[model samples]
Target chain A: AQSVSQHNHHVILSEAASLELGCNYSYGGTVNLFWYVQYPGQHLQLLLKYFSGDPLVKGIKGFEAEFIKSKFSFNLRKPSVQWSDTAEYFCAVNAPLRAGNNRKLIWGLGTSLAVNP
Target chain B: GEEVAQTPKHLVRGEGQKAKLYCAPIKGHSYVFWYQQVLKNEFKFLISFQNENVFDETGMPKERFSAKCLPNSPCSLEIQATKLEDSAVYFCASSQGTLGGQPQHFGDGTRLSIL
Candidate 1:
């Protein structure tokens, strides 16, 4: 069975601090990795996605993720975080070219980050 | 429409009552997916449809859960005799197509509370 793991469940940091949320998946085949953020009282929005090619992909709000196929990890990172960056971050993977028609995104448990202003 | 729309932001139902949720996918999207977020972080895939056709239903609790996506109408998920454990946020997402690595666009989930 394929599963996704997010290392941190809750993280608290001061504003302007660096951020790194670890994400790892168990699928051995090719996959599409994605980072989604959900702010308070808002829906999940795509932060970044890695299909192929470049290993490091940049997303909105100065967020980026590096896809390491060898480690099965697609960790989200931010150099300088803001107070508004406090939210729930989710990591999802979709393997559309796999065996079946089940194109569901296997999601992680999500990481809740709190940035103190 | 460019965003996935879900109606009735919140719903409350009795343990034995039935609960129905609706989702309108993006205008050009061909795939619609349903997921249930239980413990604020854990998400369980319920079902998915590809243009009114059931694409994947392995995750659904067939005995109590039912879903459909008909032409010219919003997709629906209904639970027969809802259980207390059915309380969760149901999220609907849509994508242009299933092929390749198309990113899914999600909607503000419908919070279902079964008392």
Candidate 2:
């Protein structure tokens, strides 16, 4: 079975501090990776995705993630985070599209991030 | 911006009552998905639809859960005889197509509480 794991359950950091959230997936085959963030009282929004090329991907709010195949990890990073960046983050994976059903996402237990100003 | 609309942001039901949730996918999106986020549990895929056809329902509980997507209308998920354990936030999402590498856009989830 394919599964995703997020190491941190909750993280606290001060404003302007660098942030890194760890994510790992257990899948033997090729997989598509994604990071999504949900602010308080808001919908889940895409932070970044890695489909095929470029392991290093940049996304909104100065957030970026690197997909390391050898490490089986896709860690989200930010040089500086703001208080507004406080939100829950989720990592997801989809198996390489085969023939039949390929639309479902396998999600990790979310990590709640709190950035204090 | 791509948007998926979900109705009844909050719902409360009795132990034996039924609960229903609705979702409308963005125009031109062919794939619709439903997920359940229970406390202390990871997000679980409930079902997926492709143009009113059931694509994958393996994650759904066949006994009490049912879903349908009517032509030219929003999709609906119905849970019969709700249990207290059924309490969770249900999310709806849509994507351009189910081919591959398509990121899904999610809607504000409907939080369901069963007493």
Candidate 3:
């Protein structure tokens, strides 16, 4: 079984401040990592994902997450966050490239980010 | 289209009553998943259906939780004799099954409140 953990429960930041949210998983084999965001009343949407190739994966809204396999971390980062970026971000993990029944996602508790103007 | 559609944005039910949630998966998608998000806890996978057949239901509480997906109809998750612990946002997501590089499309979720 695979599990995901997000260290931050809540984060407060001022506009233009940099952002980083830590995510780690417990799977030793190959895995897929994802970052999803939910705005005030919006549905959860995919921010980025990492499967293979480059360790650094860039997503929409200037968000990027780096996959550090050795550390078991895929931390989400943004150089400058805007007020509109205040939302709940979740880190999710899935088992490696199995043909079937391996695409189920295990999600983290989510990190609430509040960017004050 | 919004990819996935979940009905009754919010639902309120009394204990010992029944609550039902509906999810319409995106066209051409064969995989549908249900998850519950309780306060202070991460989203827990409830059940998953590949087309009309259930693929996995290990996370679903067998005693009180039941789900079904019919042909040409949206999938439904029903809770019999609901309890306070059932209060949470239930999300429905769909994907292209066990394929490569496909992400789940989530709905806004139906917030279930049991009194």
Q: What's each prediction's TM-score?
A: 0.97, 0.96, 0.95
DockQ score for model 1, please?
A: 0.61
Interface RMSD of each: 2.1, 2.0, 2.0
Evaluate candidate 1 and give its CAPRI docking class based on DockQ.
Answer: medium
lDDT of each: 0.92, 0.91, 0.90
lDDT of 3 by residue, B27-105 (tens): 8888898999999347999988889998888889979999998999999999999999999999999988576457899
Find the candidate with the highest DockQ and give its number: 2
Candidate 3 stretches with Cα past 4 Å from truth are A96-102
Residue by residue across B2-102, what tens digits does model 2's lDDT show? 58989899999999899999999988988899999999347999999888999788789979999999998889999999999999999999988655788
DockQ score of each predicted structure, in the order shown:
0.61, 0.68, 0.60
Residue lDDT tens for model 3, A18-115 = 99999999999878889999999899999999978999999999999999999999999999999999999999987553554546789999999999
Off by over 4 Å in 1: A96-102
True contacts kept of each: 0.50, 0.72, 0.52
